[model samples]
Structures are given as C-alpha cells and as structure tokens.
Target: MQIRLAGGRIAAEVHGSGEPLLLFHSLLADRSSFDRITGQLAESFQVIVPDLPGFGASEAVTGGLEPIADRMAEAVRDLKGSHRPIVLGNGFGAFVALQMVIRHPGLVSRLVLADCGACFSEQGREAFRTMAAVSSAKGLSALSETAMRRLFAPDFQAAHPELMQERLAAFLRTDPAVFRAACEALAGLDLRPDLTKVDVPVLVLVGEQDEATPPAMSRELAAGLPDARLMILPGCAHVPQLQAPEHFLEATLTFLTNDDTGRDSERVQAVA
Candidate 1:
C-alpha cells in the first residue's frame, strides 16, 4: 500500500510490523527484484519495498538522483514508526541512499548499501555513458545483454537461464528516459568530498565479481564514509543479494542486529 499520509508519490508494499526497514532496488531491477528475501526479512522487520522514482508504480522525478533521494526521504518520513528506518539499498538504490543520508543528516538509523560506491572510475563512468547513449538511441532492449552482464557473472547467467530471462524482462521494463537519466546521473556523480556528512552506521557489501561498480568502488565508499564496514560476497556479481541471498542476509542481519560495537561497528574501513 502507498503511504496515504505521504500522498503516494512512491509506490510501496508493507510487510509485517516492527522497526521500519525500507528496501530500495537496483537500477537494473525493480521492487520485485527483492521478492526472494522480503518474506524472511519481514519476519524481523516491517519491510517496506518501494519502486524508486521512474520505476514501476512510482511517479518519476526530475534532476537525477538528488530529487529522487529527496522523494525517498519523504517516503521515509511518512512510513517511519516508533523507530527510525534502517535502509537497505542495492546498486542505484545504494547511491540514492548515500545521497539521502548525506543530504539529510540523522534521517535513517543505519544503512545496508550493496554494490555501490562514492564515485566511479573513468572506465566505470564510460560504461554508464555508453549505456545511456545506447539506451537513449536504441532503447533499453539494445543493452539487455550488457545489463545482464553487469548484474551477474557470465557463468552465473549461463547456469541460471530462467532467472536470467526474468531479470532481462525486468530490465526491459525500465522506462528509457528514466534509465538514461539514471545512467547519466551515475556517470558524472562524485560524492567523495561529501562522504563525511553521512554520519551514520553503514554496512557496505559488494560482490567479489561485480563489473558494473566493482569492488574497488565499494572500497572507496567504505573508506570515505565516517563509519562503515565492508564485505565482499563470494561468488557473486553486482547484485549480491540476488546472486547469493544467504550470504547477503547473514552479513546484513549481523550488522543490523549487532550494535554492541558502538562506533567501531560503523568503521568504514573494516572488512570481514
């Protein structure tokens, strides 16, 4: 259900009842991308999965990720209950979450960021630019193969034909304009200078084989942020949760439930 209190710019489904846990999906995927793990997470959290702006039932926003983050903040405010939300973002959603906490200090209690970083290297930036140009000219279908490659390792794709097909369908459903805009936003984005402003506990996870954002980017993201922990999911690519759901859950749950470490848990440079 859309948050009636928030005027419904963001389309979301509510699950269970407890501390709010917002799940933000990747650019190559939609809200349904999280379907595999939402139920188990719901057992412990009131999981609210939203279709980020320009995806699914959600309304599109302008000005790239900034406004999208702003819109997401509104969703947080509307859905927040007794506790501040613990946000879990994947891929592009991770980028939006980074900006949201940066732009709005003390908003979420903590963050679980997967497959994202503060900035992309030249080669990475070029990938986005190339994708944007191709998708804008020939439409999203033209880049289906490339998008799948980024999301999963070639071996994984070859092994999981049905899942690959499903992911491809989801990728094609992305609006061409929105897809292009996000690609452009990510290509030029550099949040390294402002990383200090995040000021919240963040658990950063990247796939060992991620080609889109790469592990190096995740390393930089963890290093730049004030308090963060990094984990590399074995045998996974861009979307670690999708590729290795058990590993993803174990890391995320441990981080979310273990608060005894205090400031140390948030240390960005630590890797396990």
Candidate 2:
C-alpha cells in the first residue's frame, strides 16, 4: 500500500493483526529483508514493513534524513491511526527508529533495535561516513566481500546463498546519491544527549560477529536507554535477523510477548 507523507509517497506492506510492530530495514534493504521473520512475528503482532524513502518502493526524500525520519514517523502515525505501535529497526533503519523516538516520542511505545548503533559516539558517526562514501563512489558492486563477510558469519552466508544474493542485489540497487545523503545525515546525528528522555522499554540485539556496528556499541546503546535489555546472538554478524533467524525470532518473540523473566529477560519496569 502507498501513503502520502510529509513530502513523499510511502510504500508499505502490513501483515497479521494484533499490536502494531513497525519494522524499518537497514540501508539498501526494503520490506523484503524481514520476509522470513514477518510470518513468525505477524502470528503475534501486526507487522508493518515499509520500504524507506530512497531505498525500496518508497519515493525519494527531497529534504534529507531528518525529514525522512519525521516523514516515516508521520506515515506510521497516519497509517496505524491511534494504535500505539512497537518500533523495530535494523542497521541504518535502527538509526532512523531512534530518531523517531527522539523526535516523535508519542509515536513509539517500545523500541527493538537490532544490529545498529545509538549515534552517541564519534566512532559510529565516522563509520557511517565511511559507508556512505564507499557506497556513493562505487555503488553497491564496489562493496568489498570483506564488508559482506563482516555483515554475516561465514557459516550463515555459506548456508544461505539465495539470501545473500538477494541482500547483495538490494545493496547494488540503492541510488548512490540517496545513499550518500542518508549517510551524511547519519554522520551529523547524535542521540546520546537525549537518551535520558527515552523512558520506554528497549531491546537491543547484536550479532556476536557483527563488525559493522560491533557488540560494544550496542552495549553502549543499551546502557544509555532507561530500561533496556541487550542480547548477543552467537555466531552471527551485522544482520542477525537474516544471519540468525532462529535466535532472532526467539529473542524478539520473547521481548514482544513480555515473556522474559530473568535478569536478562523482558522487564517492563520503567526507568524513571
């Protein structure tokens, strides 16, 4: 389905019916990235996956990243109406999700951030800049196997050749200009200063072998949030949802269902 946002058209696919879960995919990926997990998640929650502007079926963002975030938040609000939705983001999509929480707090009830940074550290900014430059210069074809290798564990990529091919195709299809602009916006974003304001429950999931954002950075993101849980998926890389679907599904289901009970389990206790 398509919806008009602040400045562009949004193409989104929604599945199941229950509490709404808006999923945002990382750079170069669209709603399709969540195809495998969506059926599982949709069984419990209404999953709304949108092809972010300039990346998927959505229209280009004429204003830039911040506007893109705002537009996304608005689209969610407009699409779901009064329903309070759980927001989940992957990689660069996680960054936008955080931005949504920061700029449109009322729109997001809880956050599920996987394989992404919180944008509070210099290293994170620098890393984003590097990705943008590389993508712009050589398009997705130029992405070194070294980068792909880091994004997924050797075992997972080897086992899922078709999945890897689909991901690579998405990367190559991304427009260089849009990719560069998004990266520049990410480079300037810093959400750390406002972390305390985010009092909602947060679940942070990181792949053990994820070099793009790293586990330590995810730890920092969890640390800054009010009530947050961090889960490390074993033998996985940046895209755990794709790399470690079983673990990802288990952790995400538990979090969404509020079934976690132990120290690391789901806890609804508010920070404030």
Candidates' lDDT values, in order? 0.87, 0.76
TM-score (all chains, Cα) for each model:
0.95, 0.87
lDDT of 1 by residue, 125-179 (tens): 9999999999878888899899999999999999999999999999999999999
lDDT measured at residue 88 in model 1 versus the true structure, 0 to 100: 96
Across 1-272, the per-residue lDDT of candidate 2 in tens digits comes to: 43454344777877888888888998756667788799989888888888888766677776666778887887777755566888899988898888778777777778899887666367767876887777777665776564567567777788888888887776767777887887788778767787777757888888888877788878878877877888888777788777667778888877777854223433322211
TM-score of model 2 relative to the true fold? 0.87
* Candidate 1 residue spans exceeding 4 A from truth: 1-5, 261-272
Give lDDT: candidate 2, residue 109. 75
